[model samples]
Target: MREDIEFRTEDGVTLRGWHYAPDGATGPTPLVVMAHGFSAVKEHLLDDFAGFFCDGGLGVLVYDNRNLGASDGTPRGEIDPWQQVRDYRTAITWAQTQPWADPERIGIWGSSYSGAHVLVVAALDRRVKAVVSQVPLVSGLANARRLIRSDLFAATRQLFDADRAARYAGAAPQMMQVAWEKDPAEPAALPTQDTHDFFFGPIQDRAPNWRNEVTLRSVEMFVEYEPGAYIADIAPTPLLMVVACQDHLTVADLSLEYFEKARQPKELVALPCGHFEAYVGEAFAESAPRQLAWFRKYL
Candidate 1:
């Protein structure tokens, strides 16, 4: 039901992933193009999500974002939101041309960081027929402000400045853990308890390729991103946003605020759990089915 595939982006970087088809299917099928979030690989609960669609008689294109798991890119563990957004469009273009895929029926599913990317893509690329952004990072700057301590804000800015100067002088890019297991107060990229537990937990046994590190510059770029601003532009394309009610990383109030900014043809479903919980256990059951229904209705 799944096949390994690779395609080049416009800039010639190869992104790799799986193309899933329902068993005994024939003719062109609606395809949902998907990618993982910040510093995440497809093994991070994406296979489970893809199965929900593929099992419901839809095709799915699940890929590792560039520089993470199963995909190829340089300066590993770096994440540039705009670059990933471009790649999402690139993946959609490739999926559209596939013999088994219906070009006009392309839908997109993204979670966490890539979740925000899909919002930007759907607004800019009219070819996206439908979109599902789950537990998305809406406002990077606000999120950073919420997560970082005010007293440490100056020191944090210093980190970004020092990293910039070091790179300017030919030093290797500075790196930081994607999550910190022992202390939430640490200087890791995510710096939240749920993020640490989610990334550092047993899921690692399933996805060993996932490194705990990210480029320090990735944090700077993250704070500058404001994908929520694109929400208002996503109308005319059916959109579904899944928000975790108790989410600390991407707070619920902020997500709700942006959801209102969006015009019609959009729906918001609240999962009564924290951000990371939406990926597994009961929350996954709550989140995945509704998303599949959206794809079924609009894809």
Candidate 2:
């Protein structure tokens, strides 16, 4: 069974999500809280993963982050890492109130940027009994340096600074394409076709709420946001970090380094494909079962 649901953050921002309960569930079941990465919406193929969890007898709550999709907040395309993390906490609190959700057995799942989020959430929120982070961003500064050319890095920094100044001066926040074609004349947060197609192609027909743009301030926050520092704290709470071996976007080595720093009771799984491929087809087939088993054991 599935139902549409809404919850408010501590700031009173309304966030929307879908709640999926496994059929024939006799009582309250473990709930897995999920959200998308970057500017993605709940409809961005997240239902696919939610279905997998539901099949494994787990209730699922997949929501849109504040300020995006059906959620309510100012600055439509704003992406704040801390704010989003707080929203996850809010989601967990709301889920615990549900009659069919087991508060003590809740788990969190995310991929890409949000994959990093679950790491921090699991560390800080003891209520989170398990976590599944797939191709997560370990260090924001390292990723920013890797994606942004050294020559253009200064210019990008200037844009972020300028946007901040403009917003303070009563001007609208500057906007930029989150992903775009490779062109020296056009600047995008993710300029490669792989990144662009990864977000736009597969789920285009399904995810009408997904946007290609975000506030320039998001780039500023992206560089300074580091979730890997909290990895070690997630020990005792089982963690599963899935890596895409050929992923150029998140870089497999970066996640591996963080995994090495993490404490025991953690497992690392590597897929033979790139980042986006893991979301669908043969790759997802291999990865989703592992996630299901992990949640079953821990949550």
Candidate 3:
């Protein structure tokens, strides 16, 4: 069964979430809090994950981050990693209040950009008993250095500065395409065919609420954010880091570096596929079960 729910953040912003109870559930069950990645909504393949978890006898709470999807906030399309991390904390607090939720067994799950957010959230929020991060963005600076050419870095910085000025001058937030069809003349935040097809192809069709554009300031915040720094802190709490071996977006090597620094009670599973491919097909088939097992053992 599924129910639409709303919760208010400490800042008074009303965030929305979907609560899913396991089929034939008799009483309170462990809840897994989930959210989508960069500029994504709950409908963007998140239901598949939630369904799998719920089917595995775990309750699921999938929500949109502030300023995106069904959530109410200003300056839409803004992607602030820190703010999103805070939203995860708020989601946990809200989940604990649910009548069918086992607060002590609450776990967090995230993919892509949000995968990184869960690491930070688990580190600071001891209440989160377990965490599963798939294809996570560990270091924003490292990823920025890899994705943004050195020649274009300066130009990108200028755009960020310009957007800040424009926003302060009573202008609307500057918007940019999150991903675009491969074109040398038209650069996008994620200007690759894989990113383009994944976001604009069938996924976009399935998720009617997804916006293909994000604020310029979102890119700026993404470049400066670093979630890997908190990985080691997620020690006493169990963590599962799933990596796509052929991932160019988040890159497996950087993720491994942070994973090595992490303490015990952690597990790493490397999938034999690219970042986006891990979302479906044989890769996802291999990953989902492992996640369920980990959550079962820990949460």
Candidate 4:
């Protein structure tokens, strides 16, 4: 059965998570610590992945990052990358104490921006047994370049908002728009075509609180933050890199470069779709099972 668990972060914010324990399992099973991508709630994107693992005789702990969803924190729309990484660490540490989790066999899974956080967390926490980073955004600079090429004005405005939020620590300026807005000029602007369906369609059914707007301040730090730099140190431990050959949200070529630098015990699987399409379209069925197999082998 699955239960909702609430826990406190080091910064005094309350975080809500879903814990799925396999039926009739007597002891700790392998656990997957799953964190959501930018501007997304944990339950919407992660629950399916968690459910699959739980059904396979594993425990899955999926948590909402501090400022979004049901988590307690100020500045509702803020997206501080470093703070998110710290919160992920705290969540992983907390997962170790859950009775159904095997601390030594815990693995990390993330996609897009939070996918980068999985790498950051794994490097700092040696206890992370394995990691799966799917179509990760290894560099903030690359993301910035993509946004600029797609929409200069909207990208600039996003940067301004994020900086203002960081300086004030109050509620960040709100950006509201429909999910399927076309072009970057629209308020809830998206860079690619699949993003509209991926970000809005699924959440429309499951989570009412989902929004496409993220704190603009995230732009300031996201470009400079490179999670791929530490990939070599995580070697000998299992690391799975899922690359989308035609990704538009993140740089696919840069991801390939990082994969080249990474050491042994690493495997890269290339898919034919763009970034978000793989998560919702037919590829998800193909991708999720492949990832589960890799985690089962390593964890």
The lDDT per prediction is 0.91, 0.91, 0.90, 0.78
lDDT of 3 by residue, 54-115 (tens): 99999999999888889989788888899999999998998898788998999999998999
lDDT of 4 by residue, 103-193 (tens): 8898989988888888788777788888899889887776667755655656666667666766688654644432346564554434555
- How many collisions per candidate? 0, 0, 0, 5
Better of 2 and 4 by TM-score: 2
Winning candidate number (TM-score): 1
Off by over 4 Å in 2: 181-185
In terms of lDDT, model 1 sits at 0.91
Ranking by lDDT: 1, 2, 3, 4
Instruction: List model 2 lDDT by residue over 154-194, tens digit each.
Output: 98888888888898999999988888845534778767667
**What TM-score does prediction 3 earn?**
0.97
- Clash number for candidate 2: 0
- Once all C-alphas are superposed, what RMSD does model 2 give against the true structure? 1.2
Stretch of 10 with least lDDT, candidate 4: 171-180
User: Sorted on TM-score, highest at the top, how do the candidates line up?
Assistant: 1, 2, 3, 4
- 1 or 2, greater by TM-score: 1
Give the distance in Å from residue 243's predicted Cα in candidate 3 to where it truly belongs.
0.3
